[model samples]
Target: MSIKPAIFLPELLRHLFKRPVTVKYPFEKEPVPKDFRGNVVFDPPKCIGCMICVNDCPAEAIEIIRVSETEKKFKMLLHNDRCIHCAQCVDSCPTKAYHMDSEYEIAAFSRRHLKIEYK
Candidate 1:
């Protein structure tokens, strides 16, 4: 098969002068849009330990732990790896303890590090 240099020459010349379209993702982060579901944020003080979030979560990422006999001292553990970011847990919370944050940069090397604890 014969190689066509004429067809490739124009594309190569155009790319040489044109500026790159890709943004520096690691250095420059684009702003997250409104109503963007990134990650789960749990407020320990506002949480009533109702277990509503735990039941509503489709991913089963939310786990409620009993700190003592008192309901006020309950703790919550959220596994980010298992979470699908569907915002189901946030909607189910009556106290508005669970919320979705704008920050989406959640890359991690280990699964253990992705787990968030709320007390």
Candidate 2:
């Protein structure tokens, strides 16, 4: 066996001269995948003020505050800042009241605004 010279080069060169396939983020947003885990949404009617989500949340981000017109029912309050997106609340919700949405832009200057009542 004898090898005088050896050279290996990629055949495609047009891609180098072409515009970038990547997007400029913050200014531009790429489409989220069909199964991406982003933000959470709560369905007030579906939830029976069950404590399953509150109990199961590893982050302890969920709280159920019952409106005491009667001891029977109340609204659920969720703190978005305390949530770590573990999806525990979603998984524990028996009525499918909780779900993850594709909208991940949940940033805010005040943490209080992040808290939302299930309604």
Which residue segments of model 2 deviate by more than 4 Å?
A: 1-13, 16-19, 68-73
lDDT of 2: 0.79
4-118 in candidate 1: lDDT tens per residue? 9997999999999999999899899988899999989888878777888888889999998878785577678999999999999888899988889998889899999999998
lDDT of 1 at 2: 81
lDDT of 1: 0.88
TM-score of each: 0.78, 0.75
Candidate 2: tens digits of C-alpha lDDT, residues 2-119: 6434332232454667788888998998899987777778877676776888889988888777666655455777788988988888888998988988888899999988898764
Q: Supply candidate 1's per-residue lDDT for 104.
A: 84
| Candidate 2 minimal-lDDT segment of 10 residues | 3-12
* lDDT score for residue 100 of model 2: 87
Candidate with the greatest TM-score versus the true structure:
1
Mark the regions of model 1 whose C-alpha exceeds 4 Å error after superposition: 1-20
Span of 10 residues, lowest total lDDT, candidate 1: 66-75
